[model samples]
Target: MLRIFVIVIIANAAMAQVPFLGTCPNLEAMQNFELERYLGKWYEVERYFAWFEFGGKCVTANYSLNENASVKILNKQISSLTGVATSIEGIARLIGRSDDPKLTVTFPSLPLPFDAPYWVLDTDYISYAVVWSCTNLGVLNVRNVWILTREPKPSVAVVEKAYQIIDKNNISRAYFIRTDQKNCPVTN
Candidate 1:
């Protein structure tokens, strides 16, 4: 009896829908992404908040090629709630081929784990990048967007370029929260 009730609750949570600012079909992923050039550190300048990443500040992602031909993803953040640094490591594998920017990422240590899309929408490889991913729940959508930069803070021009791609997809900029990159503690 208790087991059945627990299953029902978990089912409802799995079917939860995230509120979005605009209506549109899934945006297309960028093509011909340079795998080597894209492998590096990227600072999260802004992002649309997700439940798993709420209250995270000074966020950054480091990507490196692994021996298995997959990419190792290290995501680091400063937790506002606990005032501590936190990080998670995951693996990203190319979906079908090396030329495409579409990939799937998974955290093996996470419970009830699943592979999630990690699509690159646009990138300059020098200054900024725009990434988008979404999961469908019936007619609703749960999506995430990230504006990443080569530096902790990006120039206005760099940010504007990313915004153009965001606007093209009809993703509301209002949902994006600017990540705090000021006066960060030095890491050894």
Candidate 2:
């Protein structure tokens, strides 16, 4: 009995550090995804807690075409406590097919040695986007999800639509936390 109790405690501790457990869900990426339409800025409305983005508010991601045909990604966030802004640049390359919404993103500034998956589960270029990434580690998985909108503060209808899409995919909305977009500092 004590051995079983110890095992359960260890499992819970491990899961507390990661985003999700069990095998990564088999979610589908957006079909016929158009990179051109997805370019420009997207404000994060909600997201799973990410260690890299701790204490960040008014998070936004901007994408543009690079000279080498890869997509250039710029993610900016303001410190909720300090009111200072910070940004990071990364490069994303299409993983398989040209139209696939799956890409590998590499942040050269970070200590990570390998590229991470950036998968678009669903998006309506003019309104909202759902991005998901998961890395399976044997018994547990590290998952990240972001609900993005073209506008910093999206309308209720828009948010409901995004939530409906997430529901269709059976992704839990429990772990997501809202990102503060009010009174954010303006940027060039």
Candidate 3:
């Protein structure tokens, strides 16, 4: 009896997913729409909040574009104490943008964890920011967003540029914490 009850609870949790289920909020109607061109190793320019293991340290998200299936991510880990680098393996797949102009990507499964991450690409070719939304409802939107670039460390201009893009979206800049950058990446 106990086992059955536990299973039911788990199943219910999985059913409850982030808002919009599979759609981007606000600025949904953009001009061009392409996912492949946007996939690449983007440097962390400015982030709303230190996400994952990068609470206080500078963090970078290394994404390699693949044609096979899921996109792999080496979310570099930085040690705030000693200023070191570590890498973790993760996958991202377009979940919500299936039939819309916007898109959101998550790890493997969706909802079950109740933290399905969705990113809406702003208007830009090289620079792009993803508004990390856990639920479809904007009322509960928190600081889980990210701004990335092709380079490891962005120039002050680029950083500001990204910030402007995010700012235009109604996101608060004060809440955003810089990703761990003790070990900055090399640029092209």
Task: Go through the candidates in order and give the C-alpha RMSD of each one to the true structure.
Answer: 3.3, 4.8, 6.1
| Residue range 34-125, candidate 2, lDDT tens digits | 99999999999999888777889999999999988899999999999899999999999999888999999889997644577899988989
Best lDDT among the predictions, by candidate number: 2
Off by over 4 Å in 1: 1-17, 20-24, 186-188
Clashing pairs in 1: none
lDDT of 3 by residue, 1-188 (tens): 99788766644433442212343445433345465666566656555433345444555566665676556666665677666666666666655444333444454433333335546545354765554454433223223566776655667776777667666666566655666555554532
Assess each prediction's global lDDT (C-alpha) against the native.
0.81, 0.86, 0.53
Model 2 bad stretches (over 4 Å):
1-18
C-alpha-based local distance difference test score of model 1: 0.81
Candidate 3 residue-wise lDDT at 159:
71
Ranking by TM-score: 2, 1, 3
Per model, state how many residue pairs clash.
Answer: 0, 0, 14
lDDT of 1 by residue, 93-182 (tens): 999878899889897777756788788899999999998877654444567789999988789999999999998988788778889988
Per-residue lDDT, model 3, residue 167, is 60
